[model samples]
Target: PLGMVMGSCVYHIAHQRMGAKIGNIGRNVEIEQFTQALYDARELAMSRMQAEAEALHAEGIVGVQLRQHSHTWGSHTTEFFAIGTAVRPLRDNHIIERPTMVLSLDS
Candidate 1:
């Protein structure tokens, strides 16, 4: 249930911009309309990434990188490219989430 393999040490770029020119789309379209398009695309890509990770039997992805194509150079197609090191944590203690705390009381 997988396709071509991926590699490591990838150069990443992340963007959250979608330009819907007037007349191209509804000029009266709310800002979220364009944003939603970008979000949906990202979610789809992430879905693919998740599948890739699952297919490889990786517990999680490390060094996850994001590449976004936001700029419209007369092109309508946009994509999200994510690359990372897929790994499976130790079975016994797999939960490795780090917690950040602001331990400060300002008066």
Candidate 2:
């Protein structure tokens, strides 16, 4: 049996104070703070999802997926969602069966 689990986090990026000074200037630079915020949000969502799986006594989560979305909250705001399927072994010595493939020949 498998259980679906999900976690979400909403984040807002702070406007750079130096952005005003650099306006109208043609220059390429890295926005470190914003990048860090994005990483943090993703980690937070994943952590929450793991916590939920732990509460359910699942051995581990499989097929984890992370998603990002922007809605009407504001231009600077974004949401990070993490989802996965929680699975547990039925017995202490459970063995995973190997998948078999069948080839069909038709001309």
Q: On residues 8-87, what C-alpha lDDT tens digit does candidate 1 reach at each position?
A: 22222333355545344644555565566667777766667777788888766766666776446535456677666667
Ten contiguous residues with the weakest lDDT in model 2? 19-28
Clashes of each: 0, 0
Candidate 1 segments whose C-alpha is farther than 4 A from its true place: 1-30, 71-73, 91-95, 98-107
lDDT of 2 by residue, 20-95 (tens): 5387267676778789999999999999999989988987887789999987858888899999998888898996
**Which consecutive 10 residues in model 1 have the weakest lDDT in total?**
7-16
Residue 11 in model 2: shift from native, Å? 0.4
- Number of the top candidate by lDDT? 2
- In candidate 1, the residue pairs with backbone N, CA or C atoms under 3 Å apart (3 or more residues apart, or in different chains) clash, namely none
